[model samples]
Target: MRIDYVINKVAQTHRGQSEGDVAQAIHDQLRAVGVVPNGRQIAQYANAISALPQLPPNATKR
Candidate 1:
């Protein structure tokens, strides 16, 4: 799987959720797609996603 796809998934599911929650959600999503990622890896992704800057409400893709 692409890193960008994982990043986007993590960002989408991170809102109003704790790190553990995000990790579990990501785990489930990946599992359904046959990618059994390790817990530590998922945790790292969650942590990294949380560190990303939040886009403004009016922000647009360019």
Candidate 2:
């Protein structure tokens, strides 16, 4: 799954929250879009993202 995309999408509205909090936000958004992840899977993605390097910028203007 595109975990990074989901995490960043959720982060736009939930700044300054813990990874767990972010994970929950992501879960809700996914559900809203009818994409239900496995139980606790969002939290797992959140934890995984925390250990990886930061995501690159969305798209730079020329």
Candidate 3:
């Protein structure tokens, strides 16, 4: 699970929202995405992000 990809996904889903809003949206999405697939969403999200230095990217960004 890529945090940057997740964050980008959340941002696109939540277009026009501020960065903080985007962050919250990502958190919620993470929880939603985690509960049913590989494992607990929150736990997976937490562990995935806990070691990260920052959020992911938007390949188009220069």
Candidate 4:
């Protein structure tokens, strides 16, 4: 599975959600698909997603 793509997609869909909320969403989604990530991994994914540059309000994804 392409985890980076997953993270980005989750971040986009959950925009304006809290970091923890987003993390949990990612965790749940992965678990549904049988990729059970632990809490630390979820936190790491959250941190990595948070570190990405934010787009302008009117910006569109390519």
Candidate 5:
């Protein structure tokens, strides 16, 4: 699943933290999982998170 979907679901399921908090938790979890290695990688993750709606998946024929 996309990160934002996962984050929104986590936020809803948690039912207490703000959306930002949920996003942060996902970001941290990603880092812990070696999804990112450094600041530049984090930037890539940030852009991915921010543009979740606008960017279409490359999996679609293009």
Candidate 6:
């Protein structure tokens, strides 16, 4: 699964929830869908994705 996609989806759907909450939710969903990632793994992935910078559409590339 795409980590970024999952992160964005969880963020959009779980607004107001804590980062850990959102990460756990994604972990649970993945488990239900037959992809098993441990809680720690999920948290690490979530943290990395959260740290990514958000750029606007008007931003120019170097």
Q: What TM-score would every model get versus the actual structure?
A: 0.62, 0.50, 0.38, 0.61, 0.35, 0.49
Tens digits of lDDT, candidate 4, 1-62 = 65656776887776555678778888878877677677888887777666656645765645
lDDT of 3 by residue, 1-62 (tens): 65567755754455454544544566666567673333345344444444444445778899
lDDT score, candidate 1: 0.70
- What lDDT, from 0 to 1, does candidate 4 have? 0.73
List the global CA lDDT of all models.
Answer: 0.70, 0.66, 0.53, 0.73, 0.50, 0.65
Candidates in order: C-alpha RMSD to true structure: 3.8, 4.9, 7.8, 3.6, 10.5, 6.4
Give the TM-score ranking, best first.
Answer: 1, 4, 2, 6, 3, 5
Candidate 2 per-residue lDDT, tens place, 1-60, comes to: 555566677655554456777678778777776686765777776665545555555697
State, as a TM-score between 0 and 1, how close model 1 is to the true structure.
0.62
Q: Looking at candidate 3, what is the lDDT of residue 60?
A: 89
How many residue pairs clash in all the candidates, one count each?
0, 0, 2, 0, 0, 0
Compared with the true structure, what per-residue lDDT tens digits does model 1 show for residues 1-62?
Answer: 55457657768657446677777778877777777688788888877766666545655756
Q: Model 6, range 1-62, lDDT digits (tens) per residue?
A: 55556656765566454567667788977766677677787877667545555434455656
RMSD (CA, Å), candidate 5 to true, equals: 10.5
lDDT of 3 at 48: 40
Winner on TM-score (2 vs 5): 2
**How accurate locally is residue 59 in candidate 6, as Cα lDDT from 0 to 100?**
53
Better of 4 and 6 by TM-score: 4
Task: Please give, for residues 1-62, the per-residue lDDT of candidate 5 as tens digits.
Answer: 35445445544443343445545666676665556535554444444455444333358676
The TM-score of predicted model 4 comes to 0.61
Let me know the TM-score candidate 3 reaches against the reference structure: 0.38
Better of 1 and 4 by lDDT: 4
| Candidate closer to the true structure by lDDT (higher is better), 3 or 4 | 4
